[model samples]
Every structure is written in structure tokens, then in C-alpha cells.
Target: MPVTTDLVQQVLRLANEVNAFAKQCGRADLSQTLVEVAARWKETETTIVVAGAQKRGKSRLINALVGRPGLLPVDADVATNCHLTLRRGPVLSATVHRNDGDVEIDPEQIADYASTTGDPAKRRDVLGVDVTMDHPLLDGVRLLDTPGVDSLTLGHRQATVAILQRADALLFALSAQDQPVLRHELEFLAEAMERVQAVAFVLTKVEDSANAQALLEENRRRLATFVADAGRSSPGTAAALAPLLEAPWLPVSAKLAEAAAAQRSLGREDRAAKLQERSGMGPLEDYIRACAGGRELTRSATVVSACVSVLSSLTAVAEDDVASASEDGAEAARRLAEVDKALEELTRTMRDRRRHAVGNQFLGREVSAIVRARLARVRQPYEQAISELGTRAALERYLAQLPESVEQSIRAAWDDIVAEVSRLVGRALNEFLAALGLEPMEMDLAKLSMPTVWSHELQSEPGESAKLDLLREGVPAATMAVTIGMALAHLNPIGFLIGPAIAAAVMSRRREWEQVHRNQAALRRLVSEQFTQAAGEITLALEREVASWRVAVEETADIALAGQRKELEARRAELRAPAGRSAADRGQARRRAADRLARAGELTERALALRGEIGPAVNALA
Candidate 1:
């Protein structure tokens, strides 16, 4: 199934708005890209934090939840190590905490594990923060803890700054002894609230404190004052977080599970006191119950589902873009097909046009004018040739037979040609004559006179011209072959008898038809020349016209093809923007997850980042 335009457009708009805002912020390169990626993460996951300062029973809280200790780092003071992430799985297992990547570690040496294998100065090795833990909240969820933010340690400032970029949720933790109103802590708070939406505060070691209620109210009042002093809300650096600062505070005693176990082991009589029954667990349990607003993992999952919806629909197979391309291609195809169809139709019509074009019936009119005009130009000698040929029956017999034979053969082959050659012959003569400014003869002039029979009148008187025998030096029989041969022998002495005899026939004619044969033969040659010229002229003109049409069609087709290419490219850009996330967000999620082990907080700082990272990867597996 194809992705819909509504889906594509919505995702595109979301990304565009984010990027545009990023531009307004004057960010470049990886930073702007980071926001877009984070937004994608937000769409897919929820950022939740569980935070507290060192010695605030933060690790103890984690230990209780996971039903295991040493799963997270439990050092004496200022604990600093990689954050371990707990993921939801059917079988219990762990991947080493890493911002960049995960590495295997021995569970026995979990305390000694690091995000990396090398030195801390070079920033090559993990800080050896063992963070893997099995907990109910960790099930179907990703969890993380950060190093106490205001630590005086060497990497503390760097780690704090590094972790801030990924603060999707803030589990701000503090003891009554340590004010949440400190400048450095306030700065971290500013960073936290600026980044994450859900901020919760945990007051740890409440069991050790005498005035827990009074301390809570005092902290709240101070926070309000601090917010007002910070120019807008909480003064100094936490002003951005004033909104979430509405006392998500929960008082809990993370004074170590050893203390809780010790309290449980107390005498039954001491446990009988109502105050004693609530001693180890009362206020802390209340805080835990209140803060436990269902499951963080589930919330994160819902967001992830949303992200997947947007991305799957927005990132690939945009139907509108693909449809547009298909439409363009189809349109172009249709046009080319139309052109092909048109060309086919044009070819058929051209045939009909050619067949119905002018014919040689005009030949009679044209040639008549030509012969008449050109006749006067010929010398008196040629006039005799024309005049004498008119009286020859031998030529007339040949001319009549020529028309019959030519017409019969042409008719048999009529379909093989466009027009008759004999007909075209007459038309060519007129055109030639006209170019030379000659008038043509009338059609009647085609009837050349030729004598086919011979007769002699007997002399008038019986006594006159005695014994005038017709045969003199030659026998002039119409069997004129022998006479022509004898004449050719006298003209050429050594050639073959047949050759000279045949050659003499070129100018030979019977006495009765010599006039007709002589001139008419010349006219036949002229007519044949005219036919060749007209046929050549018409053929050349038609060939040039067809060539021009083919070139025009080709040029038009090329233009149409070019426009289709551009529309295809624009559609592809719209699809890839929302689905493709940057690698940095992924790295941050892993890092925040890994660092949870050595964190000294009631709640982890970047749990949301962990959720963003693991939720999709896990859901995809499912």
C-alpha cells in the first residue's frame, strides 16, 4: 500500500517547522539536525528522569526496585561511572552502557565495567559505572541515571554538560542538607527544565532528617523566592524550569537498604508502636506511591507508536509524489502515443491526397500549345519533314500499334504505379515548351498522315511512253529490307551485312510513308524526355516534403520529453525528510542509559533519552 498525501504532508510540515525554527535559532550542521532527530524521538518516546544527589539513597531506591544490589554502582562517595540501562525483555540479560555503543562485560565485574576500554583523560574509556539492574519499572521501559550534577570531580562538569543535551526528563534529587537553590544546581535545573517537560524532585534521606515536613515546606518557599529572584520565576539559572518546579517533590529515605533491613530486623515490641510501624517505610512509601503515575515505559511506548506512525507514512512511498511522476510519465507516454497515432493517420491521409492529386489529363491541352508554338520556330526544311510525315501510312500503322500495346501493358500494371508514363510524357512536353516560350499544337495534330498503300495511274494514251517498265535500277518492293541492305553495302564496304542493313533502317522508310516516319520519330524522343523530367521533378519534391515533416515531429517529441524529468525530482525530496533521523540522538540515548549505574540521585536524570533509544528498537523486535 502507498503512503497517503495527508500523511506525507503532515510529516513534511512537522519537519519543516522544526528545521525552520532551528534556522531561526541560528544553528548549523549537526546541532540543527539534532533537534529534528530529537523531535522524532519525542514523537516516539517519553522523557522521564529519576534523580537524586549522592548519598541520598538513590542507589538504594534502584536496588529495591530491581531486587538486587551491585546492579548499580554503590561506592562510598562521589560515585562516578558509566550509566547502565535496563531494558524490557522476557529473559534477563544486559548490554553494556555506552553512549556510542555497547560492549559485553562480566556480571561479577559489573562494578568495574566502563562505557569504553581506554583511559578517561583521552575520553576513550567508560568511567566503569556498573548500571545494569532488573526492576519492574525497567520492564518494557528504558532507564538511565546521571552523575550528581554539582559534583566537584574532574569529569563532573563535562559529564553534566554532555548529559544536558539529552535531558528529556529530570529526576532532580537532593537532601535537606543540600539546598536545591544553589547556583550550580540551579544552573543544572535550568538546563534540565529547558530540555525536558517532565521534572520531578526527590528529597532523599528523609528518615535521617528530624523535620521532614518543615524542610519540605522550607525548600518550596526557597524555590519560590529563588524563582522570583531569577528575573522571571526561579532566579539565577533555573528560571526556565519554574513551571515544572511546582513541587514534584517527594520525600524518601534512600539512606541505604541496609537501614531498611536493619529497621525490619528490630524487636516485635518496638514494631508494635503505630509510629514505629510507619518508621522505615511511611513517608517514603507515600512519596513512591504518589510519584508512580502508572508506567513510564507505557507512556514512552505510546509516543514511540506515534513516531512510528508518522515516520512510516511520511518517510517512504509518498503516493502523491509517485502519482505525480506516474501521471507525468503517463501523460508523456500518451502524447507520444498520440503523435504516433497522428503520424499513422497523416501517412494514410497523405496516400489519399497523393492519389487524388492532379493527373496528366491536362497533357493534351499543354502539348497542343507547345507543338503549335514550336512548329513556327523550326526551319522550312523541318516543315517539309513534318508536312511530308503527315502523308505516310507506314508511320501511321506503327503509331496506332504503339498506343495499343503501351496502353494494354500499362493497364495490366496499373496498380503498381501512381500515373501512366505515356500520359506523363505529354505533360512534360508542354512544361518544357512553355519554359522556352513556345505555343503548343492542338490535339488534332497528333494524327500524322502516312501512306499505307501504293497506287499508280496508267498513262493516258496507248501509244505514248512505250514500254515504261516500273522496275529500273532498284526493286522498290515494300519488302524494303533488301533495298536498305544494298544501300548500306554501297555506303560501308566492310561491316557485316545485317549491321549496316539494321543501321540504315534508323533513317529508312517506305516511299509511301518516309515523310511520316522521319518527323514522328523525333517527336517520340521529345515525349520520352519530357516523361523522365516530370517524373524526376515530382519524386524530388515529394521526398523533400516528407523529410521536413519527419524532422518537425522529432523536434516536438524531444521538447515534450524534457519537461517530464523535472517534476519527478521534486516529489522525492518531500518523502525522505521526516523518516531519516540523525545518529547523534541514538548515541545520546545509549550514553544516558549507560551512565545510570554510578548516579547518586533518587531518580535518574536522562530516563527519557533511554526511552527514546530503546522503545523503538524493542517495539520493532516485538
Candidate 2:
């Protein structure tokens, strides 16, 4: 397997073990961090941004780099408006970012959305374009073709500057026909070098200039001089650009490279190989691959360093706790008793505080008031709609929409409750930590609260069986009574026919009105029940999080005390032994202490070894 693959596998294995350990130790926060770090390592990709001034053939160079001609638009007006991101996929796909949301478009239509030239109204909303191709060159590497740094359009310049901030490496393209190093290019490079991990200068359009070699050499010298001069004013900029300044400049004809790729695709291998050699794109491609490999190594090292630091700190803390507990005789016993008392008192106080916070009538009232206010905003419109419903079909339609409306209202109310509860829990935890004379642990209550899962459960659509039950039980009883009364009051034609018909119609409306009210009342009850359940669940989760935090703190002290007690007990047992007066007994105790110290030394050596491994990985990037 490749080094990248081997390194990733090692990292994932370590992360899994650490995550399990963290959970066992009740360190969910640390476990979550490890999980996220593993995920980031898995998704890591080397991103290169090709940026330069207008008409410098940046897009052409990118297309040639990927060995896919016309993959990116080459026209100046079309290519210089917005940033284009190219990556690998199974098939060609493109999406345009707009103010509303992303819109998928045909790969051929990318130029229209990315350009500002054709139909201003049609492309006005487009923010950027992302394209994915099936080219092997794009695997594990993404290329961003940015707008010209010195474009006449201010937006293009700003967008390029912004994109530079996120680029892992920058390929600065300069036209061979232009001066070796312009002031604008120098300024952009200075800013970009500070933000990106690596930088390289490319002298483009070499076919158009007979003195391309001279331009490349002269530009390299100019860059070195610029860095030397900038060091006097800004040492940081000089240091950041040192790698690029030491690297050689690459000069290539993007047109020739594109022609080579096209010819190869047409089966003209001989002509294509000659054109590719003259284009000098191979050296540039090799340099990019080296930079990408270096970046991956550096990134892996950084993540490993972080993980090692966390684990090492935890181990050191644990060892210190054990050492502190293994003290001698009566003094150790006294310390243990004191710690036990403090832990007991702290536990009691914390429990009381949690109960007070959760069971507080004031908090419940505040939550209820807010929920009611949100519900009231939707209730009026819902009631009006129900009242205006005229026929059985209309009533059925209204009933069908009722659950969704009620769910929306409940969700909104639940969101407010969650925010408020998080604030309360945070405040309570802070107070408890203060009482224990310890700094508060950083906690994200919202994340730990499991809001999404709870919300989904609470907002599930009500069953059709329940809806039918409400209609059947509440509507027909009143309607039947009214029909019987109307039949008995009528005898003549007017009273018998028209009166009964009017009465029956009125009674049906009344029954529907009652059923609608009943349904609303039932919905209100269901919302209240969900709110109470959510509150209880949140309260319990908060208690567990705080309790776990408290346990970790106490466990440290407890471990220390336990070690001391064990040492004291061992001494007592030795003193009571038949050979208590012998020198061999003293020798045994000394050997035990020495063995413990040796174990501690071993742990320290392992930590140092882990730290030592990171340095070479980082240096390999240079």
C-alpha cells in the first residue's frame, strides 16, 4: 500500500482506540473530537488555486494540467468573472451557486452561468460554478481556477483574494510577454504566500515569446530579490515565501499542451508526444504532484501531533494522580479522609443544585409562556380556515393539512424551549464548577442535548386512525340530536320539508364546528405533553453531562487517595510481619518504589518518541 493509505489506516485505528478509551473514561467531548479528526483526515484533499492577472491563460493551463481540453472555458470574458472549482467524479457534473440555492446545470452550460457577458439577467444571480470530471489527474486533488487578481472588475479581484485564503497551494501564472515581475503580482504573491501553504510561479504563453527562458530566469531572480527586500519590512512574509523563492520557475505553452492532449485523444501518439515535450508541462505536473504529496504528509503529521498531545496529557495526569496517592502512613490516611469528605459534600451540593434548576416553577412558566406565544401566532389562521370550510370534502382537506401545520408550530416552540433550557443548564454547570473551586468545562449544550433526534420524534405525523376516531366520536352525536328535534317540530309542507332541511344543514355545520374545536384542543394537549417530555429529557441529559464531569474531577482525587491508602496498608502489613525488623523488608519496599518510578519513566519516553515522530513529517513538506 502507498504511504498515504498506510498513514490513513493507522490514524483511523488510533482514533478508534482513543475514542473507545475516552468513552470508557467518561470523556465524551474528547471522543467526539477524535471522531471528527478522523473524518477530516479521511476527506483531506490537496487544493491548488491557479490565479493571475487577466488574459494570462490561467484556465488554459488548468485544462492542460488535467489533460482535458476545453474542460474549462478559455475565453477571457467568460473565464475571468467567477472562480471555478474542478475535481474528480464518475461523470461530468456542474452546479452553479445562486442567491437562493445551488442549481444543477448541464456541463456545457457552465460557461454561461460563470460568465458575465451573455444575458446579464440570466446569469445575474450566479455566484460561482463547480465542475467535476472523471480525469485521473484530479484524484485526491482539487483545482480552483480563480478570477484574475488584477482584473478591471473589482468583484473579480476581491473574489480571487478570498479564494486564496482557502487554497493549500497557489500556482501564480504570469504572462511571458509581460514584464518579469509586475508590482501587482508581487503584492498579490506577498498576501497569498501568507495565507497558502505553498506557492509556485508559472510563466505562461511561452509559445508567444521567443525569450521565454530569459523571462523565467529573470522572474525567479526578481522574486528572490523581492523576498529579500520584503524581509526588512516584514520578516513573516519573507519566511512564508522562502519555499517558493528557492524553487525554480516553470515556463510552459498551455496552447501546445492542449494540442498535445487533443492529438493523443485522436490517436496521433507521435505528434502528441513531441508537442507535449516542447510544451514543458511534464515538469510542472511533477512539481504539483510533489507539493500535493508533501501537503498530505504535513496534514497527517499535524493531526497525529494533536492526538498524541491529548492522549499524553491524559496519561500524565493519570500517572500523577496515582503517584500522589502512594504516600506513607498516617499522613496518607488523613489526606484520603479529607478527599472523601469533600467529594461527598460536592456530590450532595451538585444534586441539590440540579434539582433546583430543573424543578424551578419560574423556568417552567417562562418556557410555557414562550410556547404559547408561538402557538398563538398560528392558531388564529388555522381557526379561520376551519370555520370557512364549507363541505365534507373541504373539511377532509383541512384535516389533512392540520397535522403538518400543528407540527410546524410545535417545532418552532420546541426550538425556543431548547435554547432557553441550554442557557439554564450552562449557568447551573458554571455555578457548580465554581463551587468546586475548578474551572468550568467547555460544553456545547445544544449538541449534547440531542435536539434533532428529539425533534424528529416529537414532530412525527399524527396517525389517520386517531383522526378518524376524533371525527366519529365528536361529530355525529350532536348532528343526530338536532335532526330528531327538527323532525318532531315540523308537520306542514313548509315546516316539514324546508324547516327540517335547514335544521339538518345547520346541525351538520354545528357538529363540524364542535369537532374542529375538539381537534384543536387535542392538538394543544399533545403539544403540552411533548413539551413536558422534552423538558424532562433535557433536564436528565444535563444532569448526566454534569455528573460525568464531576465524576472525572473526583476520580482524579480518589485515585490519588487510593494509592496512598494502598501504600499505607502495605507498610502496615510489612511492619506486622515476623521479619519486620529485618533489612530485607526495607530493601523490598525500596525496590517497589524504584519499579514504580521506572514505569513512570517509560511513559515519559513514549510521549517523547511520539513528539519526535512529528518533526520529520513536517520537515518532509519543505
Top candidate by TM-score: 2
TM-scores for every predicted model: 0.38, 0.43
The weakest ten consecutive residues by lDDT in model 2 span 444-453
Q: Model 2 misses residue 525 by how many Å? A: 91
Candidate 2 local lDDT, 528-593, one digit each (tens): 555555445544554554454344434433443455556545443433332333455444544554
lDDT of 1 by residue, 124-144 (tens): 455434344444554334445
List runs of model 2 lying over 4 Å from the truth: 1-42, 77-81, 151-153, 298-622
How many clashes would you count in candidate 2?
A: 3
What TM-score would you give candidate 1 relative to the actual structure? 0.38
Q: Which stretches of candidate 1 lie over 4 Å from their true place?
A: 1-16, 24-26, 29-47, 76-81, 90-94, 97-102, 114-124, 127-134, 177-181, 232-239, 255-622
Instruction: Assess candidate 1 and give its lDDT.
Output: 0.41
